[model samples]
Target: MRDCCLLFQGGTQLPSSCLRDEDVVALFEGRLPVSVNVLAHHHAARCAACRTLLVTLAHGDALPSDSVPLALLPLEQGRRCSRRPSVPDATWTPPAVLDGFRLERLLGRGGMGAVYLAQDARGDRRVALKVCVALQPDERALASFATEARAIARIQHPNVVTMERVGEVDGRPYLVYEYVDGKSLAELRPPLPWPRVLDIAVGLAAGLRAAHQCGVLHRDLKPGNAILEPDGTVKLIDFGLATFVGSGGTAPRGVREVVGTPRYMAPEIRMGESATARSDLYALGLLVFELCTGRLPPVRRGACAAFKPEAGRGPAALLTEWLPGIDPGFAAVIACCLAEDPSERFAQADVLCAVLEHVRRLVAFQRTSRVFPTPWMGAGFPPPKDEGILAGHNVF
Candidate 1:
């Protein structure tokens, strides 16, 4: 212990009595005395082992080459002592006015940006102001941001949030969208009534259909991206990951990386394949399943055939077991949307919407007839038949 202390004190009597690990750590952390620091530096310059130890202690790993001098390396004291500009807290005062809009309170925030509830002075309407605050925007992120604006601008639907305009404030790209005075579906307490869930599902599908008609694909669709109005109207929001397809527009530029909420992503998307309209339908199916059962279905592995039952039952049987009380017709629609093979799923969003609308009408009719028997059915009316609900329609 005495020898170790002496070595840390920079005694030059015994050059081989090198500094201890504690001393090395202290020196790296700038905790060593000034005199000892100078002596330690001089000793480290001459000793190969001491130099390697100092480099390791400072950087947590050995450098590739020892040819670099110790003085040139970044030290703890140098980094701490250097003055750096303070980053302003944007939420503190926020801006009084940005691009002619009066900034109000923050709505939400994500990895790439923050959304604020703002009032458009010119239009006298409230709008959601989304600003990209990334210090350095990568090619993919920039392309996606621009793509979102273009995607929303091309589609006009009651069930989809509308973008008013886009502009830059202080070099940050910001988008203004029609503000939705409602909560996200994710905020809803679980076990929402099936009727209300069906309503939301119908609206979401309609919005997706509209987007699809415009040759747009919402790559990321989930409960969190859906806003539910007081009147049970669901409006789909956030097209940051949307891409265009077919003749209406070009595919998302520079979007090579897989982009979507993983849990809601389709099997093909999870496997790094390009997202199609069917992929969006798959995500919508997951969203509907969550709204119905307040939970996600069991993960499907490998191929769709794996989910097939030994008795030759369809995949819908699997979901029926997990979500009791769910209408068999509705469950079957969801299962078809979640088909591992895109070809097995609804070919278009409009077709899925039509099927869902029919199911909703049947469910409503059954509920009404069960409570109050119609005159045509005497005292009791049998529940509506599901035989013709999907008949004569090319769903697959």
Candidate 2:
């Protein structure tokens, strides 16, 4: 694939930022020099085009939306200005076969495109293929498509869905992913057993932490993005709205319009600010709250909808009113995640994972021994102040 960065330089297809198919093939085969291999991986970590090429060459598959209100359009829309076709989701017919993969059935579609369960005859595996069938290919749609493909490529964790290849059919952009066999958390009725909830919380936190460590921020984290496997694993998916943070850099300072689901949005995000790690956590907090209880967290309905963080109710109070029999400590951790102020939330996903791990240990211990333990029992009392969860104890 040609480098997008070079297109603006007199429309020349130069190898400025993107990797060539040959180099990617060598890199995938471990035939590149050590220095070049390191550099290629680093570039792939941040360059969507190169990453797409790398994944395509690695899996050996082939080659590689904007609209209403901008924000309400879909998380995949990039900030670039481009003319996009308005192909309604209901109007398109699924191609019988795309890039050697047979379309088995329609999974779902949104404002930007549709996803299908496809059969990869060569690989002998079922793959989830996402195509811009509804939007008709355009710059915005292409950018969003590559954005998700590149984002998932940077992250290598079992909890995150794996990207197999990137190719285009009939001038439309499409991505192939490992088809997950379980349902998303959004499909399950809530009020799950506390133990199960805690397990899901740990896995979800670990997954987010992996993404954060890779410098990829999932701006649109919600229950639907998390799929629960039969063995109780939560795999995080959908990075179309994800943002990559460069060294010593942050996400775009602001956005032209709000993105992500309004109910799952953080206050800052609703106000048109760039999403941060803390903001992602805020969305995660909402997700966990809904998982623990059967309903969503409290939100004010008005000109601007936002969470009631300062509302006169603590985590314990929430447990009493919304979810009884749940450990207040766990609730406190979720509250800390949903802090109204960005500075007040967990510093990063790993810190959140550390705390959740500790809570799981505490819960397991308490289940066997009914005896009231030490001061750690009240570690989550009141509310956590910043990294206060680790201030008094050695959580390492």
Candidate 3:
């Protein structure tokens, strides 16, 4: 067998012993770093068997793993391990096996990972690939990746950003998802139109319903992860902090502790308790609050907005003003979704769906009533004033 030439940029080399047969096995099974092009080059030059393994890793055509998301992994090893890899060179080119996936550019990164815009060469489709940081090869990061993949994989909804595949090349985990060519709600300038925002919320609620049906919980739901596609689709992405319930087992050992984004996290998660369906609902409600009022939910010491009709009313009154055309029952439903207590929120997605349908009807009713001029008209033709759902149609 030819000796493998392990290429280490900046003179960093993995001891030959570190690249053991067991490590290779783990690599083939989606448990190794998938982003180390240099390592792949080295392994290919030395071992024909490992070269073949490189092809497999590059193609990423393997079956999906039964493993849970990496968030659920044991973080102790990650915290204690000192095996961080050097960051890739800016001009590095990945091996040929990754040929089909054209990595066009880099996207913004988060605490756990970075995102890239890539294309599916096979289908001429675009995708967003999220690669976790390889620093230290922490077990906790691995578990988070695995957990996200497993939870999102179970959900199939048009409004949800779907997880297409999961791959691990060297020692790092990567997630492949359908590329969304729209800005996140948080990134939109001047905010979104009221109708558009409501549409997004409806679409998001629909996806959440599907997730709940599949026994999955989106522990962290926020505008930052809500994608608005060019074609007007609202997609909920980033399940990194989500949890899978009734998975026919207990919560993964590492994930049992509190995990989720702070701003959108439910009180229970903040309290270090296990997340439930209602927890997800609470997050969604918080998201709705942000979308409707251009602000966050009432935090400590903040006065709750009054339900008054004014140009710059707080979220409560704003919703009351624009939502008058909606049935009172549906308004109550939205209120219930925003309940302070998780238990008081809508427990099931179906209930929210019913409320949304009613709101849609009200929107239509209000529109028709304006166009046809009613018999109850009082005097001379009055100047047309913005009313109903259309009142806030020009959202940024």
Candidate 4:
């Protein structure tokens, strides 16, 4: 791979120079060093050969144009240049084989890449294959993809999605994840039962705790990123926006340039601050709110301003109004998770998990008591000989 940076003399026309095949492969496979990434971007802008190579690597076809979005361009001196390059008009076509995995069908596509439901020939198991789209092949996007693989690999928990392998085929980087046989929480219609919601919340929190223990911060946590298995197990998925705590810097900030979903983003994140474990907790709080009320917390967007909190009422009040029988403790936990100040929220995912577990038990006890009330013990009944139902139970 080329190690030298390409110097540009400022012109809109294509440059006379082109990238080497090795350098193009390295860039698409996310193997390029930071320095080469900047040079690759500059050269890709003017060299149709490099652009077509990237297109072929991403989609197995040539593109009509090679206009790169300004957002995808690397920031120079922490600032984005004003020039807009033409983005290539390309479409993705799933390849039959990637490495040893046989692609069964395209699962979905996102801003970063496309996912395929694939079969691992060697292991004889199905997996979700995520291939990085190479339309622009920006360094940041490649870095994010690599970060997700590293993050998921570090976390091994039943509630978190498992990564089997990561490899590049035909210059396209891809990830193999344990295929989940269920729908995302986003697909579940709201007005979900409180018990069911709490069950999912507990699992999600546990997963987050596991990730946090590994120093991986899942900056993006939303219903769409959580899957509900057939056995009621909730698995957190999509760590593309995840970052390590103290990993040097946060995402670049600008108008509509945040990395996470606006509705679930913490206040600090909305304010362009680096996301910490607490930020994940805040998103969990929002997920809980959405599950209970069938809607996200209200926010308003100005013409040029970021999203601002617009809910006139506290979460507890809104929750109580929506579900009158909701547990006060549960409501309080949600409130704490949504605290504007990171310090005010739950210190860790485990803390939130413990509280949610307790609330679950309380709800279970209440339901059981209602169903099987201790028959009004008569004077002779002697309080039913202390049935031991509440025995060994820790009073919350």
* Best TM-score among the predictions, by candidate number: 2
Candidate 3 Cα deviation (angstroms), residue 150: 1.1
lDDT of each: 0.65, 0.67, 0.56, 0.65
Best by lDDT: 2
**Would you estimate the TM-scores of all the predictions?**
0.68, 0.73, 0.62, 0.68
- TM-score, structure 1 vs. true: 0.68
What TM-score does candidate 4 get on C-alpha atoms?
0.68
Residues 1-396 of candidate 1: C-alpha lDDT, one tens digit per residue: 002212223345444234433344446646567876777777555444455546544542211111121122223422211111113233323477887989888888654567899988887688999887666544644665798899999999999999988987666678889889999987898667666777888899999999999998888798778899988888988888787798623344343334566557676654445678888988898788777777764442332211332232344565466556666667767767766667767778898787678778777777877853221232121222232112222424
lDDT for 215 in candidate 4 is: 85
Q: What stretches of model 1 exceed 4 Å from their correct place?
A: 1-94, 247-256, 301-315, 371-395
Give the local distance difference test score of model 4: 0.65
lDDT of each residue in 277-311, candidate 2, tens digit only: 87888888888878788776555443234555444
Give a tens-digit lDDT track for model 3, residues 1-396: 012234344557654444533243334434456544457455455444345444534442121121111222222323211122224322223333343577778775654566889888888788888877655556666877888899888888998888888887556788899888898877875334555555676788888888888877776677677888888788888877666667531234444354554456555554445667766766776677566556653343111211222333433444566544333333344455555555555657766665565555555566677653331133122221221111111220
RMSD of each: 15.4, 15.9, 15.8, 13.6
Candidate 2: the clashing residue pairs are: 65-140, 65-141
Model 4: per-residue lDDT, tens digit, 1-396? 122224343443322233332344446545567765666676656544444445544542211111112223333454232223334446345468878889998776665578899988897689999998766566755776788899999999999999988987655678889999998887899978877888888999999999988888887788878899999999998888776764332333334333465446676664446667778888898888889879754443321121232343556656777788666556666766776656766777886787678667767776877753222212121121121111111221
| Two-way TM-score contest, 3 vs 4, winner | 4
- Any runs in candidate 4 off by more than 4 Å, and if so which? 1-89, 246-257, 300-312, 371-396
Worst 10 residues of 2 by lDDT: 64-73
**Which window of ten consecutive residues has the lowest lDDT sum in model 3?**
387-396
